[model samples]
Target: MYKTLIYDFDGTIGDTLPICIAAFKKAVTPFLDRDISDEEIVSTFGPSEEGTIQALIPDHFDEGIHAYWQAYKELQYMAPKAFDGIQELLDDTAKAGFQNILVTGKARTSADISLEQYGLTKDFKMILTGSPKGPNKPENIVKALKETGTNASDALYVGDAPSDITSAHAANIKIAAALWGSIIEPEKVAALKPDYTCRSVADFRQIVLPE
Candidate 1:
């Protein structure tokens, strides 16, 4: 069992992918003459909001981020919901003495809004958001481990993206694939060979807290 659990916010913890894509498209519309594809938007997504914005709208990165969050925050609905059983999982993990930490590409403000909306603001012990000059995901993972006083051997990083897997691996941490929150094909994910593939909450519990 792990003593620390590091999580990715979008897609993994919060179902914000749809709204995020919409916001990205809306953000770039004013700057782009033509439509931007969803794949393009997703591919450019990095560990920080500004990183993604800069990739998408290098000419007007700051303006793009402002517009993106403006559209994103204005929407009351379509923010995101915690995936099925996610709250229970977090609660259980906490009760079992694991330190829950968050590493998100969303700006701290945007991440807080979603966490508050979902009533998950208190679930994490430490939160590392991707601000304009914040550390990237891999760096955040290292920080989470250090802050929580947990070693990589005693920590598990769960996420739904290839980048998350790569980051965890780079940080010398074990990684688990959240199949339920997967955005990529299962075959593709399988090829990445995560230490564990959690198809359901039960699978997650089995791997992280087997008794």
Candidate 2:
């Protein structure tokens, strides 16, 4: 009896990684003389943008955060939406009597902006944003499980990153690898032996809303 569906926001619910990367570049490039590679920006992902800035630009941490927010808000217009069928899935979960919780490694501010922009602020009951210290999904998953009063055995955590798979297991719950994002490497995610693997949100809908 799966009573809960824990979700990852960036690649699972929304295609937000590109805007995040672009905004980060826009925010920090002014502080650096050299061009920052996309890979470098992505490598600093585990933590929130605050942590990303702390790691990359400690000297101007305060200013970097402020600029990043401005840039993210401005450039987010490009994304402007969530993936198709995401709202349907959220509805399915609710209709099926499963509690929905969002636990992501994204900064709280950026997460709010993205969710609001996508008109999904009301979809989740519990939304835990990222940490500046490091990847905190494992702990947050545990927190969600406890908050929902659901046992780990009866819950599923869905995410699109390899680290997501790792963190889900760390929290002792079944994980569904969401390989729908363009940037996701299917082979890499499948290699982790996740409990369920969905190549698209439609594929995932079947598991949660089977007829």
Candidate 3:
């Protein structure tokens, strides 16, 4: 039903939220005298890791990013692998000649680190990382379609976040809520009425790559 698959990275492809949040907290701990709440950090997510730091401590943006990367790379074991079936899904889609594109809320460096650690760097035809300004999925989604010469109708955006659903709809694309990640609230995501609600990557594969 679709010719192109657009993906989200953190909770969607790799179980990365653990390391992301941990690293973020670790990165900002020194600058903050008091403990930082997870919600406080999460609220800064529209921008990339650096942007998050910029929001929290503009004077320490560069230092915060360095600390974040140090912790992120060292804490890789928290997200040691992709969701179980993601590699196969990418492989199968490749064999079927589907265009795979990644639009992630992670900064490019962090995204590259995760992809490199997972040994799945070459899967996407294009990859758009998060901005230092704000969350730009909707605009980036449209940009991905245009860059790939794909029509919105022929593409499906597979993501785990509610914002992802909103972005997909804003870009006039079909959305499949990927509910397989550990940290996501499935019930909340489901309440948004995505075009497809997949409990696992296998379910997503069935819809997009059915024979």
State TM-scores per candidate. Answer: 0.90, 0.97, 0.97
Kindly list the per-residue Cα lDDT of model 2 for residues 67-177, writing each as its tens digit.
Answer: 999988888777788888998889878988999999999988999999889999999999998999999999999999988899999999999999999999899999999
**Residue 117 error for model 2, in Å?**
0.3
Query: Considering every candidate listed, which one attains the maximal lDDT?
Result: 3
lDDT value for candidate 3? 0.91
Q: How close to the true structure is residue 128 of candidate 1, measured as C-alpha lDDT?
A: 90
- Estimate, for each residue in 75-147, the C-alpha lDDT of model 1 and write its tens digit: 5377446887889889988898889899887888788878887899999999998856544888889988887
Ten residues in sequence with the least summed lDDT for candidate 3? 183-192
After the best TM-score superposition of candidate 1, give how far the Cα of residue 173 lies from its true spot, in angstroms. 1.2
| lDDT of each candidate versus the true structure | 0.81, 0.90, 0.91
lDDT of 2: 0.90
Ten residues in sequence with the least summed lDDT for candidate 1: 72-81
User: 124, model 3: CA deviation in Å?
Assistant: 0.6
